[model samples]
Target: MKIYFDYKVQDYLADESFRRWVLDGGFRNQDSAWSQWLLQNPDYAGEAMKARDIVLATQLTEEPFEEGYFDTIRRETMGAIQVKRRFVRPLWWQAAAAVVLVSGLLGWLVFYQAPSPETEVATQENVPAENVPFFQKNTSSAILPVALPDGSSVLLHPHSELSYHYGPAGTREVQLTGKAFFEVLKDPASPFLVYSGEMVTKVLGTSFTVTAYATDADFSVVVKTGKVAVSAPKEKNEATPGNADNQTTIHLVSNEQLFFNREKAHFKRREINQRDMLQYVPATHYAYAFEDTPVAEVFRQIGKAYGLDIDMEESLFSGCELTTNLTDEPLFEKLSIVCSAVGPGTSFVVEEGRIKVLSKGCNQ
Candidate 1:
């Protein structure tokens, strides 16, 4: 998932997903990310709403694709090695976006990188040449999707770099120069090794993010699912005083993160559950079902699960009860369904980075 918090009005207007969500009334399904984003980053809501309005208004009116549109955008993008962050309005987004869609270049927003000047992207049919080392860089403003030779995958953050090599015994080794999220295919026979300048992360089958910039003094690893073992040089481990364990490797599980200071050679691990925000939080992470449960209580569980602060008058919904299985629905749809069960004149809204439940009264 791309970083939604960093997006401005123009960014949202330029995004096909956001535009599709707005125009298709698709807030109830996987497109609920927009609602979740609005709830998490309220500061961007006004701009998002404005962009939403523009999409609904101008995008609805079908516009013709002007010639030279593709070449113009590609030329502009290729010239800038470092795409500067911009906070501006989209002047002619509708027509240009339609052109990109019609031409089947929807992936123009993101491009893969190679060591040389050219862009290299691997597909199911066209895999990267084996035994030939190649570099993948995220030169665009969005995260770049990387498909490794193995079933393993990676989400390379913007400006990050990665290169992989096959080792003996079928082991997989990759060197990372910046932040990136990795989801390795489970292969007990072949262990995956990520070499971050300061430390190395090894995993049999896991999902995690490594942030270790060459110029930065601090490095970190956060595990999302499965296990990760981080190990540094013996000198770096033994340098820190008072570490009686003399352990050079630190193992981390899900929701746990490890931080290392390159200067001090000190390692600190912290549990990150409340504030660790990602652009996409799968609804299936937690199964939510109700058996004649109070509406207020249900909302509270959802709020805590999603790390959302829900503002509601508990007393107002005290009399309302709901019983249903909501294991597979997106968050906003769950809320809408619950509101309907609680009776009329009741609903929810995203306000100021929180969810506010509006109710006239509970069902009598």
Candidate 2:
């Protein structure tokens, strides 16, 4: 009768009150009591919903055994018991012994089911028979490298755990409980997916970093190379077979990042700063100075250096030129100087980590 707020999905399934609430559609007073409790504890809603789905999926609609099955079981069990004892008891005692044997046999029959040949073959084909669950916990002082079965690698941070199954499949999936950097091997056919709490990060063959801990208030995914798709997990009813279209998905290219607010369920996209890139791309011999440089080329260099995308009206800046001796200023400072040099009415706006250039043509 006492249900803790921290109970997991399995715990909810095992609770008699919880089962009654779910099976009866929460109509009774007892059901309403549990429902009110869930409303008061919003954090438990997700687990309760999952447990409800499991119960519904596995609910028995009818008796498993066919007609006359129990009669046959009763007869067989009584014969076995009589043969084992090999002694004649009183008629009443013999009948009572048979009833006890039948009850025990019925209990076993209810809990166990022998799969048919077709069912066994179907299970082997659909389920991952060859793949076994693999788990790695990084408790070391330094970052640990985990080699996956698909030739991809993950650099797990300290206090983090990563789990996945290994098999020859077209899709690779992993679950993470903390921060980790992934370098996935190229397999266009088999996309790699990482599940972290409410969000799911997916990629074909890319390098990325994910920070998502149960204790953290926010979750983040940063793409270092290639493309990644981040989205919330689809509800059970919304997940269609063989359909990959995710309406909530946000596609990210290299140098982009997605931040998810756990409480609000909001997603904010941003570009990675240049200072953060220093660790990935070492300082090269490239110069930041531009002397009558084409506007397109200037923007290209800045985008490449900082891992950003600069959106501009190419026709407007077709013949435009920029002349400035840019230093190691912040990214926005450099953009301010560029916009000012372009024209008097020229301006730029930053939204969703991409810079949008607005200008009234240099010729005007």
Candidate 3:
């Protein structure tokens, strides 16, 4: 038997309104196949939506969606009994029948075995050889800059790749994994979009930095100049990639920075100093906001900046708070200085590029 949900169900799944429906659909705690499949799976929802769009795109023959269009979809969604036979049918009838065949195949794959929820979403794979854009690495800067046919530029950080098509109807699209800085050429007609998993940053003519690493708990965007609009894909979470349910689009004016937490599904925008913008650059001076930051978090940030391993006991910083300047000290030295403020008894061990904060409150 052909496998697929009825058309109404498919449309409901795609409808943004139905997101809440699925959430509250009482599918929770059920062994029901459909419920078990989509209860908390955003990736499943994304796939289902893609299938729905493909089906709808093929079936709609007029400007407006017909009232009983879903009814027709339902009939077509079931087994091929209702499907018109193409070989014996007239030319137009055969063509119409072909649409149902393709739709049914898509329905089976998407509804039958949906892909698992993934933090990393690859938009296109196995791209045609001709469609593949050229890539070159700049080891000196640890930047892999893709040379576009249009003279526009995207400097990909280490471990990043960009792809785009050339010639007319060519759209520049880059897939980012780690981080990248964009210096897009002005092209009002051809908008440039950089897709990092589900998050999409669109630009007309602006330079911006995007950080979306798999290991990173959060994705960030910092605009050096011009304006950039950052939005998530329709199929992905409404919130920024890592955020929970906070669906807010952040518009970065020049010199503004925003961080989207994938785990929390929320983001915050703050006015950053020119110095802060330079921190992400390699070998540049680092910056931090120590306004009531947790001691543990401060150490973690320092570790990331210093490219050193940091290990601390959980209880040490459970309730510790820090208010200090981390402006320009080298990694180990900075940690030593911060430890001194806590107390004299507090000491640390440095071994093999790893720093471990030891002892409790320092004895003055």
- Cα TM-score of candidate 1: 0.42
What are the lDDT scores of the predictions, listed in order? 0.65, 0.66, 0.55
Candidate order by TM-score, decreasing, is 1, 2, 3
- Candidate 1 lDDT, tens digit per residue, 1-364? 5778777789999999998888788655543878887777788789888988888788445687655667645743443221111111134433433332222221211122233323333332233334445467777765555656554656677788999876766678899998887777667788999998868899987678898888879898988766789987556535566665554799887778898888777789988873572532221242355877988898888766545557898989776777755532234545655665565456665433346778776752
The lDDT of model 3 is 0.55
| TM-score per candidate, chains pooled | 0.42, 0.39, 0.37
lDDT of 3 at 302: 71
Give per-residue lDDT, candidate 3, residue 25.
52
* TM-score of model number 2: 0.39
Candidate 1 ranges beyond 4 A from true positions: 1-130, 235-247, 277-364
In angstroms, the error of model 3 at 349 is 47
Consecutive 10-residue window with the lowest summed lDDT within model 2 = 105-114
lDDT tens per residue, model 2, 1-364:
4766779999989998888888888823544978788877888889988988888888877858655567745854564454335224335444444443333222222212212433433333433455645677877655554545455656677799988864366579999999887777657788899999989898877678899989988898887766799997445466676677533688887678788887766788999886784444323222365778888778777756555567888788887776655543334444544654554455555433246766687623
Per-residue accuracy of model 3 over 44-93 as CA lDDT, tens digit each? 56665554445445543568765566764574334223211213433543
